[model samples]
Target: MKLESNLPKQSPWLYTAPLLNTILLLLVYFLFTSDFVVQSGISVEHPESNSRLTGFDRAHIITVAAGTDSALYFDGLRISQPELREKLKANREGERRAIIHADKHAPHGRVIEIGNMALDLGYEVAYSTVPPKS
Candidate 1:
């Protein structure tokens, strides 16, 4: 009497299954752990502070970028002062809260002027600050 083979033949894909699974797991781990920073419109060096604040996600962000022109950016768009005034006036109809991110070396007067404009438009302004280095 003839006996059937006990061992099954393995396919090429099965040989690489373990390695594929490990690679897939590592890809997922890095994707989940990598920090995703939402870049505000402009780049600025936020001053260090000891105070902790609440959410700024819902608040409008106004960035004061220091350079030759010292421009203002909102929602990643460079807007003129007149345009900013108009936008703020319109936004005041809704939740009037703003987060100002001014460069550490930016003109204090310009930043103050922007903050005052926000306030006058009924916006509750908050300055963005980073934690002091350890």
Candidate 2:
């Protein structure tokens, strides 16, 4: 006796379902775990440099900007030199490091002043520069 089959055979595409699902899951995981550093509100025209940064953590960021007014911004908030000093003094208890994003047009003295303050507060200071042009 011959058996009658009514349902259509499964599509070949079904074979790749597991693989597609696995790839999508991995993509999502990597997207979330990737180190994505968002710069604070201060916009800076960073000076180009051949030097590369290594082992840098941007948890604490300071932005030195120049234009109508030269100012120091900490975590996106405009702050005075004394305020910055106080901040570093308090943060000294924890990680003693800061990533300074100083505008290329900013006064050289201001950048130096900030770095000195950080050093005085016992912080290992790091400067952020744009990658050299190809």
Query: What TM-score against the true fold does each predicted structure earn?
Result: 0.70, 0.81
Q: What C-alpha lDDT do the candidate models reach, one value each?
A: 0.85, 0.85
Provide the clashing-pair count of each candidate structure: 0, 0
RMSD of 1: 4.8
Worst 10 residues of 2 by lDDT: 51-60
For candidate 1, what is the TM-score?
0.70
Q: 47-125, model 1: which lDDT tens digit per residue?
A: 9999977766578888898876779987678898789999998774676788888898889999999999999888889
On a 0 to 100 scale, what is the lDDT of residue 54 in model 2? 69
Q: Which stretches of candidate 1 lie over 4 Å from their true place?
A: 1-38
What is the C-alpha lDDT profile of model 2 across 4-90, one tens digit per residue? 999999998999999999999999999987857657777789999888876666558899998757788988999998998988888
Q: Which ranges in model 2 have alpha carbons more than 4 Å from their true place?
A: 1-13, 33-35
Candidate 2: C-alpha RMSD to true structure equals 4.2
RMSD of each: 4.8, 4.2
Q: Model 1, 37: alpha-carbon shift in Å? A: 4.5
Top TM-score hit: 2
